[model samples]
Target chain A: MAELWELSAAALRAAIGRGEVSCHEVAQAHLDRCAALDPRVRAFVTLTPGTALAQADHWDAARARGEALPPLAGIPIALKDNFCTRGIRTTCSSKILGDWQPPYDATATRLVREAGCVLLGKTNLDEFAMGSSTENSGLFTTRNPWDLDRVPGGSSGGSAAAVAACMSPLATGSDTGGSIRQPAALCGVVGMKPTYGRVSRYGLVAFASSLDQIGPFARSVEDAALLLQALAVPDPLDSTSLPVEAPDYRAALTGDVRGLRIGVPREYFAEGVHETVRTAVRRALDLFCDLGATVEETSTPHAEYGLACYYIIAPAEASSNLARYDGVRYGIRADNARDVIGMFEETRDLGFGDEVKHRIMLGTYALSAGYYDAYYDKALRVRTLVKQDFERCWERYDVLVAPTSPEVAFRIGEKAGDPLAMKLSDICTIPVNMAGNCAISLPCGFQDGLPIGLQIIGKSLDEATVLRAAHAYEQAANWQPRVPSLSP
Target chain B: MPRLTLAEVEHVALLSRLRLTETEKQKLADDLNVILQQFDRLQAVDTREVPPTAHAMTLTNVFRADTARPSLPRAELLHGAPEARDEFFVVPRVVDTE
Candidate 1:
């Protein structure tokens, strides 16, 4: 029998709701798994076994009283470190906020609690969600569960790794330029980034306000949908949160893709994609065609400009958003500084890691007095072109298909010194964020013993089609049952 | 390609209020130059009539109702402060004496 920790969130929810298992038992199973695996995986920044058990007991007690249970009651879920959890440390994996705890919960956190989900702990990430690898974490790098020497693709790396290793069945991740999808792809899990504004960003540590979005990582597409259902409520606190009613993401997973139009963007396959990844994605596309979906080559001309546009735009926004982290209001303050300027400089200099500093410098330069038009404005115009490119592509096709990342997970420290090389891993995923569309990355096949991700992207707010196609492929691909082998 | 000199990096760091070590400043200069050079590709695409997209959503001016609601208590809000003094954040003096 599969261990309780390895069960899908949907399965656990059903078991808990049917009274087949107590919530405390489920929480204990996962806590024991974490205690056994976390030393090697290092997926969590902090573990909340005590709180998890207590919450689970509360659910069990409520069940004894014949109270109605929420959809996700008693499911142990992990939050990416960037999401603020009241009275729990929300570090964004940065040294600056390392010891700081939030005074209130993020909208997503509050929603999960309201649904009676047990909080496992906060997972690790790139400091301030900045890098492609969790190596940029001010704490420590989370190893890929498939291969500890290699990195779990990053920013959301720890969350993906946690789910992949069965440390948690469902976890929340924020994607700004493929943070969630790439890591999910690399770790052999299901990760979906809902349309920008589909989920509220209230209380999420802002890396780039316009681009950042919270989503879920799970072992299966249906489990991902289950978590998304709990998190998809509109929030009044976030101005960008869409007021549109969320569809039944779980109900939409019919596992049928017949007559679905899949567009294969020529730009996604042009160069840099590894041969193994290309083969796996191409095979997956062929399977879609075999399943009665028509696949056609489509053009997205400005797709090549996505990374450049994102780097410019995200950092420009980050430069403004991160200005609040000065020594005054919250977070670590440099004690030796004599004046305000010195304090701000010293505090940030000590608090932020290298990648954060690099982006801040780039953003500062891009948004500076003289270069604003030449850099930031130009990037925004290119952003419009990129969006238009997708809009035109969507006119002909229902959804686009592409490789989630160009290659399998690289060894840790391989691209650590090269920023451009690390940025290249996000090539396929950034354009989706740029267009404010929904996309999902699922394990299509294994390349050289490592998993490859196939990305299915949908039009703005059209997560149903994306999820449907992904579910169909996932059901046919039969890759969901595979788990990483971690030897103690 | 525009070269980001060490001096310019220092200037940007100052603008960003980040105190970088000499090594980080040099590394950042090279990294920024490489990234800026890559961004130079945007200049080739003629966006003559294309308006800039500042955000992904089309909704503009999202205003909430003007009704008073309870907010975080003063103590709660101040709890995360690095240093607090009697319900207020403590900061270094901004004014300088000649």
Candidate 2:
């Protein structure tokens, strides 16, 4: 049998159910792993060991009393710090929010807690989840579990690294651009972004509201599906939350994709992607073909504009949403401000990081009187064409298969100081956010000892097919997930 | 798209409710210019017929039933406030009486 921390969330739940393992044992094993491994991985921003053990004890008592348990009762899960946990310090890896314990739980956080999952606590992210690399984190940067020198990817880096290192079997992450998928790819774990509106976003620290969707990160496609099943429920609190019922995602992992129509978007293979990463994705396509799924080359021409469009759209939304964080409300305030206007200016200037200010400035400029049509409006129009590109593919395809990222994890600070270069890292995965479609990334193969991700993208609200296809490929490929070897 | 001047950079900062140092303004001007120059490609693409997408998915006004319900206790909500006094948040004076 694998080590206790190495078991999947599904397995951990079953173990607790069967009395083969106490919920306490499972919680302790994972918490111990986090304690041992987190010094190097830096995956967690806050860890609640006492609360975790208390939850485990409650579940163990319920089990001893013969009470039926929630499906995810004893599973340990990490949350991206951006998700508000009622009393937990939910920093989005930013100094702007100073030890803020939100008043209410984010809908997703509430659902996960209700599902009886033991909390492994909040993990780090790029401040406000604005950058592709965790290097933008105002808090400590989370290192890739595969190689400590490399980044784990961001703004969900800590969540990805946590799951990849087995500190926790599952984690919650939010993806505005490639936050979840890119990090999962770099860390050799399975990460998924549900379609916009598929998951409720109420109480999530707003970054790019329209593009942000909560997701799951796990070691396997099945584990990711399990976490998403618990998270993808609708919420009235969030007006944009889909009113439709969620499909049974765990049951969707049927390990078969017979006759499934897979479209290979040619633009995803542009010269911007590293050859080795593209090659690995191509090999995964062949494996899918062998599973009886048909693959055909297609085009999403406007997807090339995704990064540029995303920069405008995301920042524009960010600037507006972030304005709520004034000194008078929650978060920190600047001292020595003489007037209200001075307070707002000084508070934001003092609290926000350089990247946050940069985006805010860019966003403010785009939305300013004269430049509105030139920048924001034009980007929105470009966004429409990008969405149409996916719409066209969906007319004839069940799913789109592509590389999740242009390259594998790079050494920390490799793209630091070069904002454009860092932004370009999200090239492959950003298009899906622009299209508001569901997508999942799983390890297809390795490049130079780092994992390469093969993204299975489904149309909006079509996560069932996405999970089915990724599960089919994962099972067929049977690639063993790797954990980093920490050596002195 | 034209490069942003340092003055325009300062204007943008003020609009964003942020204060930038002189060095920061000069730096932001250069950064924004380089970044915006890349976006200049959009102007060439004729989007005359393209409608903008503010929200990606189809959405309708979501109306909730009108009812009085308990809100989060003000104490819990205001716990993180920089300054609070007697059920109200305290801020620097918004208007001048002098």
DockQ for each numbered candidate: 0.84, 0.86
Expressed as tens digits, the lDDT of each residue in B43-92 for candidate 1 is 89998899999898798878888999988888877888889989789889
True contacts kept of each: 0.86, 0.86
RMSD values, in order shown: 1.1, 1.0
Candidate 2 chain A, poorest ten consecutive residues by summed lDDT: A479-488
- Evaluated on CA atoms against the true complex, candidate 2 attains a DockQ of 0.86
Error of 1 at B14 (Å): 0.9
Best by DockQ: 2
Clashing pairs in 1: none
Please report how far candidate 2 places residue B85 from its true position, in Å: 1.5
Please state the error at residue A243 of candidate 2 in Å. 0.7
* Model 2 Cα lDDT, one tens digit per residue, A1-488: 78999899888878888899998999999999999999999999999998899999999999999999998998999999999999889888888789888999999998998899999889999999988768888888998888899999988999999999999999999999999999999899999999999999999989999999999999988889888999989899999999989988888989889999999999999998999998999999898889999999999998888889998999999999999877887889998899999999998988889999999999999999999999999999999999999999999999999999899998998887776889988999999999899999999888778888889899999999999999989888988646666554
Please give the range of 10 consecutive residues that has the lowest summed lDDT in model 1 chain A.
A479-488
